[model samples]
Target: MRVQEIPIREIRRPLYRQNDQNKVKALMESIQEIGLQEPIDVLEVDGQYYGFSGCHRYEACTRLGHETIRCNVRRAPRAVLKMHLA
Candidate 1:
């Protein structure tokens, strides 16, 4: 998997579930201490990325005001990209 530092603003997250502040805080602490242990998965399309998983990790970084995050990017199929684009 290719690791890339993606801009936080360029990554889209699904809103199906609400983020837990407690978990986010814990995660943020872990991240601060150890750095991002695991890279998040992302689908790259048209220079932007969409996160399909790792929501908690994403939120933790967001709360930390991270400008970029390490991600495992993969080219998404046209159909999948279209789904996230809108």
Candidate 2:
């Protein structure tokens, strides 16, 4: 596991989620003011980055035009990723 800044466009979001607009707005404000307080968790499988959590934060950062995002990266096997997908 590691913490690093990754290009937001490189991450793959496999899940479809509806983010709370209010939360996204609040996060956008906080991120603009103090930067991202919490890094989003992502899985690195076969060198591919996959994001399954922190949907709100992701949306906020995306809307803010951030090129990269802070992430807590966990390298996992394809099987583990399949489990997440399933």
Candidate 3:
């Protein structure tokens, strides 16, 4: 895995997840104070990025108007991506 900053618009979230507003608000404050402590995990397939976790953090950053997010990138095959989608 490699850590990098990726454009939020470039990463596709395949699953619809509901994040807690309180948690997101807290995270937004923490991120604003200290920045993101941990990078979100993402899968890279065919040059495309997909996010499967970190829903709360993602929402927090998005609400904070962040254009890019830090991610732990793992390159995977289309089959793996299909498995995630499934």
Evaluated against the true structure, the overall lDDT of model 1 is: 0.86
Indicate the residue-level lDDT of 79 in model 1.
88
Candidate numbers, best TM-score first, in rank order: 2, 3, 1
Using lDDT as the yardstick, the better of models 1 and 2 is 2
Superposed model 1: Cα runs more than 4 Å off: 82-86
Worst 10 residues of 1 by lDDT: 12-21
Q: How far off is model 1, as Cα RMSD?
A: 2.3
Model 3 agreement with the true structure over 1-86: per-residue lDDT tens digits: 99999999999999999899999999999999999999999999999999999999999999999999999999999999999998
Query: Among all windows of ten consecutive residues in candidate 3, which has the lowest summed lDDT?
Result: 13-22
What is the per-residue lDDT of model 2 for residues 1-86, given as tens digits with 9 covering 90 to 100? 79999999999999999999999999999999999999999999999999999999999999999999999999999999999999
Cα lDDT of model 3 overall?
Answer: 0.97
Instruction: Kindly provide the TM-score of model 1 when superposed on the true structure, using C-alpha atoms.
Output: 0.83
- What's the residue-level lDDT of 23 in candidate 3? 96
- lDDT, candidate 1, 1-86, per-residue tens: 59989998988875465778899899999999999989999987777688878888999998898999999999877688777647
